[model samples]
Target: MCFGYWLETRGHQVTIATHENFASFVRQFDLKFAPIAGNMEEFLQSKQGQRLIAGEKLKKEEGDKLLLQQLESAWSACQGSEVIIYTPLATFGYHIAEKLGVSCFFASVLPLTPQGCLGF
Candidate 1:
């Protein structure tokens, strides 16, 4: 929403990649949203994610596969973006975006912390 507001204030063409429902939220603003494919809710809680993190009886992978999935999803959406700006959790996503030949810019919703907020 802030991004849309900023773009409107600056009179720049802005296309926002967001959930379809959010279209109403930014209705008054001149921004376009590219909805992510599939059921957004289910995508966030997929079994692949649980397996990647080693849920209950599962074993964890050498690397985080859940994060990788996120990357794939976000990167796919980045195709329509001149530049992609994502939260820190999007490092994996940014990697995929770069692989897809799009510009990626990392943004954070929180301040730097010692609790390991860095993304590899």
Candidate 2:
């Protein structure tokens, strides 16, 4: 969210594609909001979510289905975009950008290195 705000301050048009629950929060920063499927609160209360919180991985088929759903939602939100900026969790953005014939950039709020520090 802060990143989107910073980009907007630089005169770039920023649209934040996230869960529907965050629409109002994104709008608070004056950034365009694109709805992504799923609600965090509801998910957290689900059996699958509880399993994940307990450190158990989903079965392959379950994981694949969830990934497909997220990809579809993300693809829908990204239509007509000239560029895509995504985090590690949203690596599907790269594939979407390729399909759309657009440029893509990777961004992350977390440390990328095993050393727990950014090289730059």
Candidate 3:
């Protein structure tokens, strides 16, 4: 909704890739969507996903892999955009942009990750 509003106000064509639950909502804004496979319920069924979401355990290696997968998915969805404005909270987005050799500008609402954490 926020992305759609921003795109409308700025008069930009925005493509949003999300789960089916949001398809109808995004359609209301006439925004483009590349539907993502697997819902939150499916992810929660995974051992690693369950552990991460439940805060029951932490697996840096597995978490990193999942993050990379998500980034790749998002990058694929945003292909062909002239510029991608990635919100700072999306650490995976930043990495995927850099990896794809795309120009990106980041926005931040508050301090979350440490300055050096992004490897700037």
The best candidate in terms of TM-score: 2
**Cα-based TM-score, every candidate:** 0.50, 0.74, 0.58
Q: Per-residue alpha-carbon lDDT of model 1 for 1-120, expressed as tens digits?
A: 565567656776666655455566656565666654344355446775466346454445623464455445555567656666776544555665667677777776566665342332
Task: Identify the runs in model 1 with alpha carbons over 4 angstroms from their true place.
Answer: 38-76, 88-92, 109-120
Error of 3 at 43 (Å): 2.4
- In candidate 2, what are the lDDT values of residues 1-120, reduced to their tens digit? 676677777788888888789889889988999887778667777998899889999898866766777788999999989889988767888999999999999988575556412222
Task: Name the lDDT value of residue 118 in candidate 2.
Answer: 27
lDDT of 3 by residue, 10-117 (tens): 887777666556678778877777654445556677886678678776657756665565666677877777566666435555666677678776766465765543
User: Model 3 lDDT vs. the true structure?
Assistant: 0.65
The CA-based lDDT of model 1 is what? 0.57
Q: Pick the winner on TM-score between candidates 1 and 3.
A: 3
Alpha-carbon error at 72 in model 3, in Å? 4.2
Query: Local error of candidate 2 at 104, Å?
Result: 1.9
| Model 2 ranges off by over 4 Å | 60-66, 110-120
Better of 1 and 3 by lDDT: 3
Scored against the true structure, residue 11 in model 1 reaches a CA lDDT of 74
TM-score for candidate 3, residues paired by index: 0.58
Off by over 4 Å in 3: 45-48, 57-72, 86-90, 105-120
